[model samples]
Target: MTSQFPNTLTPKMVEGIKGFNLCTFLIGLEGWRRGLTLKYYSDINQYSDIHTQGKKLMGRNYSLQSKDKIHYFNQSRGDMVSNEAVRIAQSKQKTKDYLEKGNVNILPSKEFDKTHSDVDIIKLAREIGYPVIIKPTYGSLSKGVMLNLKNDSELTDALKYVRGQLGYSNVILERYFEGADIRVYVVNNVAVAALRREPPKVTGDGESSIEKLINEKNESRKDNPYLAARPIKIDKELKDVLRKNNYKLSSILENGKTIMVKNKSTLTQGVDLYDITDTVPEHVKQLAIDTLNALPNIIHGSIDMLFDGEEAVVLEVNASANISMHMFPTEGQPRSIASFLMDFYFPETKGKSSNHTNMYFDFVDIVNTLKQNYTNYVEVKSLPQPPLYAKKYIVTGEVQNVGYRNWIRRQATKRELHGYTKNLKNGNVVVVVASHEKEKVDKFKRVCKKGSKKSKVSDVKSSDWTKEIKMGFEIKDNITKKKKEVDKKYINELLTELKETQTKLENAKKMQEELRMERDSYKDKLSSIRNSTSWRVTEPVRVIGGLLKGKTKVKN
Candidate 1:
């Protein structure tokens, strides 16, 4: 995920803010930055509910709180949505029924069960028509979905795999939509973000194969926080699409040629999501809002639709839709979906805090402690406002590799400071410490003068540091001045030692083989001598002679 969008985080702020956590943290942090307290918890006891601080929370769910209000969320779903609405959204057939009852335009479609025969399915298909999509009745994220079935054969194969192989007993069939796949995020009857799910594609340079082009595209995409989470996989479906076009990943395309890499476009399909919040027509956004409004207890979410030039058709509505895509699109201006969510939830906090802020909590630690079962919930310290106290101390003298950095790290950690100590090339160590408390920063500066036992600090120069300070204390061995000649010499030494050892082992093995051959030859000669007729006759005579010599003792 190559990141084209601007990053406001500390250069190396906590990672693990990807996947589901990406959306979860974005939405949670958006509110928390507005002077709200945020807490993330696990549902260890799924059947248990919680009453903390006199408020009855459904469970140990993730929540954002203020003095007067607190909103609990199960993933992306907030307390505003009812369980009924959630249930309806979970089922495609039920969602269709709800939307139709609300007079929202739906594509001609029908749901079927396992009882429906192939003939019956074909009959209904003829009535509704060909070139349709067949998907599980309760599928999400494009799983068990077959798009654009042109005839009975295509539909049959799709059904066989999605139903028979995948074990989805119920399915819905709908007309093949001709348009871009668009999702409009609606909140409080207002359109917030609209994104077009573009299929994975590549433009040829007339130099590289399609595979190489895709690799290059991926190289750029891997830096993005959202797009890089799940890279575009070259799977069977993508191969099939290429084969259909008389091409393969290895086939080099003509310069300036662009082709869609896959047929289906969705998050599951590694679609290149583009934020088109501005370009999507006002009507399309309105339709999204209207469709969202039609559902009961559903105030906000993403409405999936397909839009041709003239018409837009609602496909489905996602209740707990992730806002990550909107926040970080592969291309186009990133939409501030978080602000919209915060505005809906805490209207009074609008503009109270700038959205262009860098106040982020330790998302990685909280998630980790939960997984370790350290506790059910880890309440992240609501990050304070910007312009935190920062200080820098460059300790000159016997600081490098003398446990000086580790000692400083311990001191900083004890004081709960945020920053790092790194070794410099000039036999000095740079220690940067930051915190919300000025006294803590000043005390750390004083402590830098007194390093580890072995360190002989000549002078400790202190100054105010203005750079972004990361969330935790660390000792960094950050020298990048590589000694290529020294590395080559070391490698040569190792190779020489290894080659000598290998030769010695090989010679030893050869000697062992020679000894084994000699032993085998002697044993073969002895067996031949024993098996001969003369040796058998001599054996009795030799035994008689031995008895004669021992006659006195044997009394024979």
Candidate 2:
């Protein structure tokens, strides 16, 4: 559509021709107020005057003669046209011109293509290449845009499926661009705000199962605007994607780990958006504007750009873009979109600039702070002298029943310190020692700090006694002397019994060796005797003759 301001005129004529007086053009008034200009107030009052007074600023010849008079020569509406054209130009790959200067305005009675088909879009993509985008021609936001189609088969399959489901054949197919998607809002030929959206994520707690967590998230989405409208449904698409990542709904998630469901950070999908305005360097802003200008028919529209590093590619533009912050507000406040519309209506009032000086931080406060707290600041100092006179301390906890007393005893013995430790009645350790070396005291303190593994130091009370102590360390007798006497007597008896048993065992071993030697000697002697007997003949008296003689004697 042609701008109310005529484009045929020279720069001088353009400047001389007045726009809608502040009162008549609502958008223009909005621009001035947002522009932070004092002239905006003057213009507002002037419009109010025209409503009340008969006088005119430029006399009656000017287009806006009175409050009711419409200024047909204004270019406020041209913003929408220029924005659309810039988008188209960028999508068509007009890089340099779009960057240098954004699209100015659309031609008179300009119209976008109302009907487009998947088949026609596919042809465009195939001409562009295998990878192209297929989206609805008349889509809201970025619905129905797909990427990375390698062949006609996939395209045909997708085309047939969407057409059957949505019952709309007018789908937009454009060349696919790979990179991070960006959203930038341009108001009245100037970029107002921009943001880079990140994909969705879920962090793991190491305890909850992914499916349980997803259910919880879905439940939460019932209250969250970003995820409320269309709850994230568990379907074949999500299942397939999850399966590809080796993720099962029942899988336990590790703590601090994040899982991403989709590639884009759209409210309809699962994704997170991190604001990048602070990090968006100067050059990037120019590139975005350039990308927008390439689209010839877009004015007052949002341009989505895909960027890898500094190299940006123009994505689809949204003509009737939703004031997105409704679904997701920016950092702090909900933006005043109505005011933005008012600015677009009043274009001429915004040209006047405000000269208010902004106050910033001063250095006097820094010096004052230093003076107040300078002594408290960190400073390097020499180490303090070590403790001069060493004192023995006995500290214990749940040490006795847990064999901690023995541990302490062994430690003291190893150190050759004069001290003895024993378990107390109330589960405390009582130790006494006389040591002068500072190093030993330090070492003992160190050991006390880390007590026995099973023991907890509930209290450690120490005192310096007035009574003179002996130098040599000894295991002092217990207050119950009878128990100590019994223990000592038992130990002596055990030692004596062990010695007697050991002597008897040695004697028995010696006798066994001696007997074995004697047996061996006898065997040799027997062998010699047997050899001598074999050599000699044997003539002996018969037992039968002796028996006959004995019988004869009996008979006599």
Candidate 3:
């Protein structure tokens, strides 16, 4: 009934697109879908570095342009968002100070540096009153943020953790506000979406221990693209929550019982974000928009707040909020956060192109190339413009392993096409090619009908293609299994899932056979017992005893 978190993250989860890279991808994809030329670069050599997985990945920069309109971005922070805006959002003290100066309601707080010792910090807390929160003045996101310290003991430990352990010299001590913590996303002065933030928690099903429940939740998180990167870790914060609630990892949480496992509502710690876009009070959303405007050089992004009683108070303004979270909320309908961002940056592209697209550039491959030292920088292949002519050829009969895909790839390359040839799981060769000339696409159908030299083609069925296609033709086979060679993780994920399913099916068959054998043994033992003289001899006595027992319990 109990379990351990194998680990916070899966082996391959963190290696793929994540964090800032993910944010930039979501936005860039939106632009790419809109028929814009989107390119992913390792780094332009004039940006900050993002440290992740032991390697310092320089700014995952990208750009979206169509004609004279172009926008460069370092992750989600676009070039239009000034460095001053980033600095203000990054510093806790500056955020509160600027909001107050703008007459925006903020929690009362005071800031301090290394000059203030532990005793000095505690004295300042007493002056500010109990039930306060203290965090680093600069970094570590929510790791050092401690809320609801009702006494000196909790405050002292919080101070020690942030200052000593975290080594953050400058810290801010603020009165912890009470209410539902939420984040409101404002775009172009519009309160586009709102979501409530809650500490990571799990509801009991009565059959599972708290630990088992946590593991199950973690498994489900692996399915979510946004949640998969961050995990519900069993750390000191989780332990403190369990201790306070008188629950243990082995404790069986009764059905319908919900308990918070982590204090801070951070995605890194498995915090949950629930979309309340449609139902949140209009006034609260307006307040979010006003607070966002209070910050200079920032026209949009998320605003952290607390709905304290009947009113709302701004906690912080995000200059570069991860729009991916809004696009993929844990509950409720997903908002068009990425679309709204596109509208803000490129107003001319509003409602011009279809929302759906099958084509996507390999952003991870670009970053991998940078890390692998293949290149210090990679100028990603530019996406093609719209009004493209596309077609798909499904060639069957001795197609696979006969260089059919390679031949098709060569033919498509010769035609100056942009697409790929792949071997289908059903032993068919599928070639999808696109070009600006419809005549070329129609002409390729005749070439595909002839088939390759070693291939005996039974049929060649062609269809008109409307979905998006990346620029360039390549053959996808065992030679191209590298993650960098693929555009999306969908192919790898599907293959791995299929392999796992096959293994599970084999194991299931073995289990079923074992159970069948066990059932036969039980049947044989029962048959023996029924055929024995003892069973026959006890039959009459057993019937009489049963009759008597039934009469005694009967309520007539």
Best by TM-score: 1
Q: Rank the candidates by lDDT, best first.
A: 1, 3, 2
Q: How much does each candidate deviate from the true structure in C-alpha RMSD?
A: 11.0, 36.9, 21.9
- Per-residue error at 454 for model 3, in Å? 1.9
lDDT, candidate 2, residue 426?
64
Q: What is the lDDT of residue 518 in candidate 3?
A: 100
Measured by C-alpha RMSD in angstroms, how accurate is candidate 1? 11.0
lDDT of 2 by residue, 1-556 (tens): 0011111111221122222221122232233223322111212223332221122222111122123323321222232354334333323223223433544221111111336555565566566676655655444435455555568987786676556565545555555566676766666566666666655456789999877777766675443333344444566546755797999878888998988655444545643433455465556666556555555545455556776776665554544344433223323232333244444645443432221001111112222333454432211111112122234556755666675666666676666554456556666676654344556755676565467778777656655532222222344424676886898899999999999998988988889889989998999888776577553433134456688899999999
Which segments of model 3 are wrong by more than 4 Å?
Answer: 1-15, 45-59, 372-392, 416-419, 424-426, 434-443, 462-471, 478-556
lDDT (0-100) at residue 432 of candidate 2? 50
Give the top-scoring candidate (lDDT): 1
For model 3 the TM-score comes to 0.77
- Candidate 2 regions with alpha-carbon error over 4 angstroms: 1-130, 150-157, 218-227, 263-267, 291-299, 326-339, 346-556
lDDT by residue (1-556, candidate 3, tens digit) is 1112212222232246777777776777678767677766554434333211113454357678888777777666677667777888888888888888888888888889988888988898899898898888886336678889999999988888889998988998888888888889887789998888788889999989988999888888775667777778987878778999899999999999988888778758877778888878998988888887778878777888888658888877777677767755677667767778888888888875453354556666667776776655555455555557789999888988787787888888887888888888898888888876788888888788887899888888999886646657877664455755564577788889999999999999999999999999999999999999999999999999999999989954
Cα lDDT of model 1 by residue, 102-193, tens digit? 88988989898989876777778888888899888987777887888899998888888888888998999898888888999998888988
Model 1 stretches with alpha carbons more than 4 Å out? 1-3, 44-61, 352-356, 413-416, 424-427, 437-444, 459-468, 476-556
